[model samples]
Target: MISRMFSRFNISIGSVTHQIFKKPTSLSRSVIARKFCNEIARPENFATAGTMNDVHIKMMERIGLEPGYSPIPRSREHLIQYQPSSADLPPRSMADSFTSAVIPLSSSKSLQDLYVSYLGHVRFGRLMQDMDLFAVWVCHQHVNIPNLDKNIHLPYTFVTIMVDKIDFTDFSPKGTSDIRLSGHVSWVGKSSMEIVVWLEQEFEGTYKKITRALFLMAARNATNTGPAPVNQISPGNEHEQNILIGGEERKKRRIDHQKMSLLKVVPSNYEQSIMHDIFTRITRKDTIQLDKRVLPANGKWMADCSIMNTIPCFPEHRNAHNKVFGGFIMKIALENSWVCAYLHAKSRPKLETISDISFEKPVDVSSFLQMNAYVTYTEMNFMVVMVVADVLNPTGGRMTSNVLYYVWKCNESVPEVIPGSYHEMMWYLMGRRKLNYALGLTSGV
Candidate 1:
């Protein structure tokens, strides 16, 4: 059935043109933390202008950082890049240039300068991107049928946008950033929609526009769109296509990523899946590596690998100080790995300890971070996930590396492991474990 969210909203596509975005210092962790400390050291009871000051309060107490944390700010910067209605959009399919360049983004630019300039513009971009995406969803949800109520309802983030791909102009400032995003969506299934996102960069303004990408997203028919069946996008096809799928697709039972619903508030797993989709869709990655784990009946499991992008990083991924926010990356890498582990563990096992995890170098928020994870040991109902981070640079050559380690316990709580699945699961886990160990990857927390 057409979603209610789609049914209630108005359906006219609109645009805010010739807009600019400014970086927000308050959006950064360092700045937020500093402000958080100054405001309320203990981070006790507080109010954030009201809705959920408590969540932020708890966050500060637990992580000693501001509870106002949101990756939305980074996403906000992304909105401005859209071709405004009054502005010109590239005519060619936007799939040509594909490469990542590493450049210095934190050139001692003060947070005040970055914030004043970036955030101010960002607000405009945010308003524009959101309005456009909303407009598209508003229009599409109507099915454009007559006799329909102009009042339509769409689940939050229910619209899907795809236009002919256009040639991308090198937008990253020299010595500032090395990444730009490529977006592509095709009309797939009747109700299901598919999108392709890639991250690319240019250093000398000389490299080929792009030839590779690895990112993609799937949206179905709901308040939130589900996987669509478009000929142009194939989440399963890695080598030929240039994008990553945000949600994981499993055979027998649906993996958490694929099992999304907006009936009651979106499920947590679904939310994560959607978030991944936004990032992948925004970046337009060519290939994506996912971290996964599984538990078996006889003794086996498998974990999807991490996503590695040759594309340079954008300022959005960095911090006010320009350093790749270790915590943010760590959380993303870890959470994704955990989800992969969950996929591998069909038996629904419990969490175990995180093996040795370490960060090699300080990744610049502006440089791309190549990350991956894997699992091995089916019989033991155990899996180890690893992550590798490579920093991209436009001039000095790629130079930084980081890694993560995740350990999952197959049968910690249950006495005999699940009813009839332990034995077979053991076999699978053991085989995967061997493969993971052979890779000789570094570990991380």
Candidate 2:
């Protein structure tokens, strides 16, 4: 069954363009942090806006600074270099190169629409959207040079290339007040940077970590046409060095995974494979029907447990370059997957991992999108949800645009799912791979 599924998909290995990323070799933390703060410090005093109103004053304040104080170092005379020195800093410890924003979840309906799950806990998709948004904000803060014309901010355009290890160790209850998002450049490459964002809840004047995500975003040309150079991030501590190494490892792992997925190895040729027994059992039974899909012993099937949602590519969901937002697409896909998981479990299922979301092309705000999701795989209490997004054309046609897969950890209330067709089986195997990689059962960066 596994071999057949692999062959039916016609998977092939391909080469990816490789580039060498450079990192600072040696430097002390204080020196590097000092140089970094000086290089990227806000040129004009935030208080320059005279007679600031409540909102304006609030915007001018930095999270960790003293009241009314900004992130700009008290003095720049200590700096000797014009750019980042050879050291790394955590997103929060980036001196002045950080961005923070807070979103108050005051409305129940809006929370339900974006973050609430069938089980009433905040869904994972909402965090993914905020992670992407906050990563972009951090990237802009890091790379946006002061334009000669102050009114025209020439910020570097960016799109999320990948997000890895989004750990949801702490759950956010549905009615939790407001969450603060802070992010900064943790690693930098020639044309890419790793933005680490943390989602936290404030309680009695203290912040508690809810989730943290590592977003690998690539800088694009001012016109948003192709990859462009980005300022390198200097690591300033052991923690920062670890993050840079991790980012490097993840980049390599992503490339290797892409290659492995395309590898043309025949699964049936390996008799010693872990899946060999199952494959043999399924193939040897000639009397058993294979043409018809099989239902689980409990009679659970795809059609009975799936979700279909239709939404427009709203203008507010557009990226800086005016295309439909990738984060928005991910948000919808996550919601659909959550609904599908709920239908199968008959209760709320916790998100294990968002394995993958591949965008075939950028979507336009003018189009109507149809999102279809299904419980593609289930075993014990493990479930995998797949969401396929398509653009509805005016000529009665549909164009596939995005494919998202999520691995969920459900409670005992969730029932098992049975694959009914070769097509369904393919998704099942793919979903299994996703779950395995997410759990570190299989190698992923």
Taken over the whole model, the C-alpha lDDT of each candidate is 0.32, 0.60
lDDT of 2 by residue, 191-244 (tens): 788777777776667776776666778876544555666656565565555555
Model 2, position 202, has a per-residue lDDT of: 64
**lDDT by residue for model 1 (164-220), tens:** 111222232332333233333322333333333232334566432321111112332
lDDT of 1 at 272: 36
Looking at model 2, residue 433 earns an lDDT score of 70
Best by lDDT: 2
Best by TM-score: 2
Give the clash count for model 2. Answer: 9
TM-score of each: 0.26, 0.71
In model 2, the runs with Cα more than 4 Å from the true position are 1-96, 106-124, 144-151, 174-176, 262-296, 302-305
